[model samples]
Target chain A: MPSGALLFQSVLLGILLGGLYALLASGLTLYFGIMRVVMIAHSAFLILAAYLGWWLHERAGLDPLLAMLGTVPLFFGAGVLLQRVLLTRLRPATLTMMSVLLTFAIALLIEGLLGYAFTGTQRRVQLGYGSASLEVFGARVAVVKLIAFGLAVVALGTLYVLMKRTRFGWALRATIQHRDAARLLGIDTDRVAGYGFGIGLATAAIGGTALSLDTTIYPSLHWHWIGPLMAIIVVGGLGSVPGAAIAAMVLGMAQSLLQIPMGTTWAQTVFYVALFATLAIRPQGFFGGRLAQRF
Target chain B: MPSGSKVLKLAAVALLAVAVLAFPSIAPNPYILSAGVLVVYYAVLATSWNFVGGFTGYISLGHGALAGLGAYSTGILVAKAGLPPFLALAAAGAFVGLLAVPIGLAALRVRGASFVIVSISLVLILLLVFQSWSSVTGGSRGLVVPRPFQLTRPEHHRIFYFLFAGLLALAVLAWWLIDRSRFGLGLKSIREDEDKAEALGTATYAYKLIVFVVSAVFTALAGGLYALWFGDLDPVFQFSILTGSYLVLMALLGGVRQLFGPVVGALIVGIALEFFKVEYGDTPLHLVATGLLLALVVLFMPDGVLPAIADLIKRFGRSDRTSIREVSAAELREQRLQNAGGTK
Candidate 1:
């Protein structure tokens, strides 16, 4: 119904949205990959980080993008402490069920604290170029979206290299693939899990900073994001970062394309629907057979 | 298993039922009656949730959506079709029950954490659908249900209080019947080991579907009743994940293995939550308190407070006779651990 230019523009916009989604989902996959914990509180952490960005921007006059430089490591340390203090004590036998309850409690705690501090009112980062758009091949792209996409690409690329090229990343991957075997090879898995969880939270900081740049956020807004991020990870295959990234892009494009045909609310159903369809058809996901399910 | 103890237990239950029935008559206060009504509503929701989540060992986070479906179904039928309120309520429950068939089939294929994800996604999808379908659902403006009975506010609250209390009793009765039946044993087997159950000739899928539908139907009934009693239907409150998780929290906190676990859970949580909201006003303190309660319960009383208390009571009393019949819940945990498979 729309022109070729319109469809192209929607696809581009969708890709940008997917990139943002991928940033959030990659952290979830990393946690699940290494810790075998669902980390349902992930969106809550992302929201908290976004609030941090908002606070930094308001008080220190730092850009949200720049705020991540300080907050990411801070969050990483928090995650490590969290793992060491609480999650590490859970029995491996009941981790799958217990973690859901534990993380749910953690999520409620974070949401309540954030609500207590910031109230439920929505807040957004007022950055330069927020309302400006650049024309590219007849499609107008918001500069904020472009920057978010660029940040997502850079973060994801760093994650890819860290997993593939570094010793710690290799240790992390080895632990994920076969924990007992890796332990036999002297991988100090407890330390890896602690750091792995920290890495996941660090990614949340990145995603949160990007989110503040583009959208209005409140303590409760995490509820709206959890479903879509989970869907992306599920569609990508539970622990595969590259698979999740591709799935996020595909979901983003589908949502954008659907928006052309229907309303935006209806378009948002794309990922959840994809999630159900994926579970029904291929529960192992697009990256099935690549890795054994760790739990 | 002693005859005298059985008779004593029956007497205790009978006395409790009589007291509950006489509560409205004795109190005669609108505030107390409303709180009673809220507690009964939660009892019905949490007990119904236990059918799937407890007996069947599927941690469903989408039961709230079932209730929402029921509320909207009743609302639409009464508001748009001009159906009678009571008839619409029954129809709404059945409608939601039928709706769960395909969804349960799709979601129950996956196990453990994936199932939780699917369950949450279903509720979110339903919430979005109800919110966006403004033409039928009235969207964010909300829908009002026509009350069938004409009575004063206090009298209306009293009547609904009785109605919800009766529903809770019925739900408990159904839970008891299911617990004693072959069909329930089939479900417990599925909860224990689906593959083993199937190998041993249990139709695991059918049993799961039946229990899931039954759970959804009762949840829908509570929703429809809530819509009627409250006279307002908003998708956000009706289909909220927070409400869904609260259902899990109550059921888990009360001891899902016990038939009346949800009732005790509902009573404690419902009353505490009400008082907290009243005391704390609009701040996030109530949520913080709820989180603390859930954490404390999960950490200290993993088998639920009822079982833990029963254990303490037995220890203090030093009775050789078993006070409560223990279900094979340990097997359920074993099944989940097996599903978790390799260490991570």
Candidate 2:
């Protein structure tokens, strides 16, 4: 076995990785909660936003973190437009099933466009402090990871408040809990769906920015992320925000810790294995109950 | 059925089969003949996927993995054990089909998005496994399968084209038998609603498992044939989600619910895709085009091209034969309003 210091350091690193993953999964859950879309394209959008961040950093000289201030609203608007234009027209009876194919097409469209524009080369957001590290408990931690973790915490915190405290958030939550009943009580479900989809996709802006800083990205990298994100959301109980957050961190940590014994390639199996085990044992997931299922 | 029309339909099918069989002889160049090989290859794989997906309403985005396994097994058998290429393919197909039992048990437990996730996760897991297990799979460096055929390149393509066409014919015959059988009804009931089907005495889980295995076998056979024919085994290409989705796309675009849907879809999509790749030289343009085509098909022809065209023909050519249920709710309401106005 490896030394205790490496394991301890990995635990911290895994938590940070989970936080980044949570930022992506939360958006997926929000879309599932409101519109029942699997949002397979969310992975593509995350990478697209990462490319945006990389572009902003390179062409405009903006910091990758600062680039989010511009990309979030842009993605939000794109999400709303997507709902209004294509998704809103789908029959409610087949929304869950049909959305898979629809979103899959959307994913291909985005991935292709990104590939066309950027090519398939891997990229990273270079930072002056990229190589800097701090020692703790005889283990070294990268500063970029700490900043990315901080960003996740802040963004997730704000998202929590927005989901719980504000009236708009309540409207969104009400729709998640009971969409038809909420509509019967005079909630404009269509509009809520639009905004909900928007807010969900907007989270990718944060995730993409953080991810670009943490690791290398390429146009086709979205394919690698899709399985893990799907696993996290499934384990978190489909539409539950808090469940997604917790699951992300837990799986993230499991993956990180397994790296010591499993190595990196084998360690990645954590998500797929977790996904299968969860579906077999607890398809409803942690917070699923009645809320997670659409029909 | 009218005797004359029935004879005509049979003749049409026979003519089409003959043409398909004769394609290798008539093709202008080896390039076109190889393209035909690719098209029929897709036909068999799509039909294989349709065995489960079309009947059960369960969309598996991981059939590519089944095909990949089939190809890899063929590679290993031929490369390591010195099995004849043809016999190895049959065994590989059977082996992967058997492998589907454990896979189906785990995957068929969930429905809807969960099923899609499970299907996709299976492929991802396999991709990782094959990539990491370099000793067995050759990992990224790729395993080389010896060319079993001693013929020239064009001759090899010709032989594989006939091989795949024969496979497609067998698959279609199996599908036809299944579609007309009691087992098909059980599968359809499960597709319509599994819980209700089980309550009504259908062995829903068994039907799903059986068909999933059957589907895996055919898909694997296609993959195995190609692996031996192509002489290379790359894990990434074999287990790709893109390949999986393409199978789903071809099946869906042609009309998953219909007997000829996958064949039609494979022809259109496979040919168009080949054309794009050839013309555009590999710039992701074909991907964009594919995405656009899939999006349009989903939006406008959700029932697939075959069904939609059939519906259109029914509406325009034989309106009196239109089923009441085929009428949209909005159209029914408008008709009711028009009748009320006429009575007034």
Candidate 3:
């Protein structure tokens, strides 16, 4: 219903948005792939990292990008400790339920602490580049978004190389494909799980920083994150990083295009409807292989 | 001596029932009475949830959506169709039960974690639907249901308290009947091993459907009661994830297999939340506390508080007779054979 130029712009914006979404979902899918943990509290962690970035930027007058240097490692360590201390104790058969409860608890704890510290007020990180835009094919694209997309592509590319080339990456991949067999091969699954959780949390830091630059955030942003993240993971096939990337792009385009005709709220509804339909038709997901193994 | 113990147990139950019935009358304050109403409402919801989750091992996260469906239906009927409050409540329950059929069909085919995921997705989808369909469903602002009875506000609170308490009692009785019935055994068998049960000709799908519908109906009744008590309805309040979590928490905190586990869990958690709210105002600390408690319970007392307490009581009392009944291997095998033969 819209003009060709307008539609093209929307698609471009959607692709840029999708790139960031893919980065966020990549961490979640990768964690699930290796450890069989869904990490329901992932959104909470992402929001927490965003809050941390906002705090450092506002209080210390540090740039948001530099703030991540401190937050990412701290989050990674916390993730490793979480997997080693708490998640490791739960039995494999009951891992899904236990992880759900554990992550839920973590989310609640984070939300409580954040609420206490920051109150429920919304805050945004303001970089000098926040308002800057560039002309691309006659459509204005925000400078921050462009930077974020580039960062996501680079990060994802690094992750891809890490998974395919390095010995640790092979170990991680082997664990994902066959954890028990990998364990039998003396891979030290505990170490792998700890690192996998760290990697997942580290990705959240990247996503949080990028997202805070784009929009206002509050503790309640976790609620908004879970649905879309879940949709991406479901569409991409759980644990498939490439699948997640493609799914994010598709969802982003669908949502943006729908927004033109249906408006924002309806557009959101259509995205979820598509997610639900896709899940119902193929629970294994768009590119899900033999990974149909239960969490 | 065993007969005497049984008599004592029955007497204790009767006294507890009488006390609960007279609570609103004896309590002077409106807040306490309202809390009592909430406890009853939660008891009904949690106990109904146990039918499928506790007994059948389905662990549905979408029960809250079914409850919302019932509440909204009652809201529409009372507000637009000009139906009486009580009739609307019954109709709401029926409607929600019917709605559960297709969702159950699609989801019940999966096992364990997949089932949980499907249930959660169903609730999320329902929430989206409820929020988007504003013209008929009142959108996000929600429809306000008019008070049906003419009484003082405090008196109205008392009336609803007793009404919910009655419903809670009815729900408990229904669960008790189901637990003692052959149907309950069949469900338990399915939970333990669906493939094995199917091999024995248990008709697992049919039984699961029945349990799902029954659970939905009772949960819907609780929702209807909630609508009446709140005198309003909102999509967020009705179909929230918190509602689902509360149901799961209550069921888990109490021994899921026990008839009164959910009731006890609801009461304890409800009282705990009230205490926290009074102490800390409206901070999110109460949710944090619940989350901590849930994690601790799962980690240490996986069987829940009731069973743990029961075990403690048995140990201190040193009563051999109080030990749980155990079936020997041969007897279990014979029962299985009998079940298989009966099915054939």
For model 2, give the interface RMSD.
2.4
Off by over 4 Å in 1: A290-295, B1-5, B192-201, B319-344
- CAPRI grade of model 1: medium
- lDDT, candidate 3, B1-344, per-residue tens: 57865797789779979988889888889988888888888888999999998777667767888888888899899998989999999999989889888667655654554556556666666777888889888999889998889888889999898888888889889999998899988898776666778899998878998999999999998998788778888888788777787788888899788888998899988788778878999887766787788778767765678878878988987576746673323346668889999999
Arrange candidates, best TM-score first.
Answer: 2, 1, 3
Q: Give me candidate 1's TM-score against the actual structure.
A: 0.93
- When 1 and 2 are scored with DockQ, the better candidate is 2
Model 3 sits at a Cα RMSD from the real structure of: 5.1
Winning model by lDDT: 2
TM-score of every model versus the real structure: 0.93, 0.94, 0.91
Q: What tens digits encode model 2's per-residue C-alpha lDDT throughout A119-177?
A: 98888888888889999889899988988888889988998999889988888888888
Across residues A46-155, which tens digit of lDDT does each residue of candidate 3 receive? 89988988999999988878888998899899989988998887755356666776777687778878888999898988788889999888888899888788878887
Highest DockQ against the true fold, candidate: 2
> Model 3, which residues run further than 4 Å from truth?
A293-295, B1-9, B122-129, B193-206, B319-344
Quote the lDDT for A195 in model 3: 92
Q: lDDT rank, highest first?
A: 2, 1, 3
Report residue B18 deviation for candidate 1 (angstroms). 2.3
What lDDT score belongs to each candidate, Candidate 1 first?
0.85, 0.86, 0.81
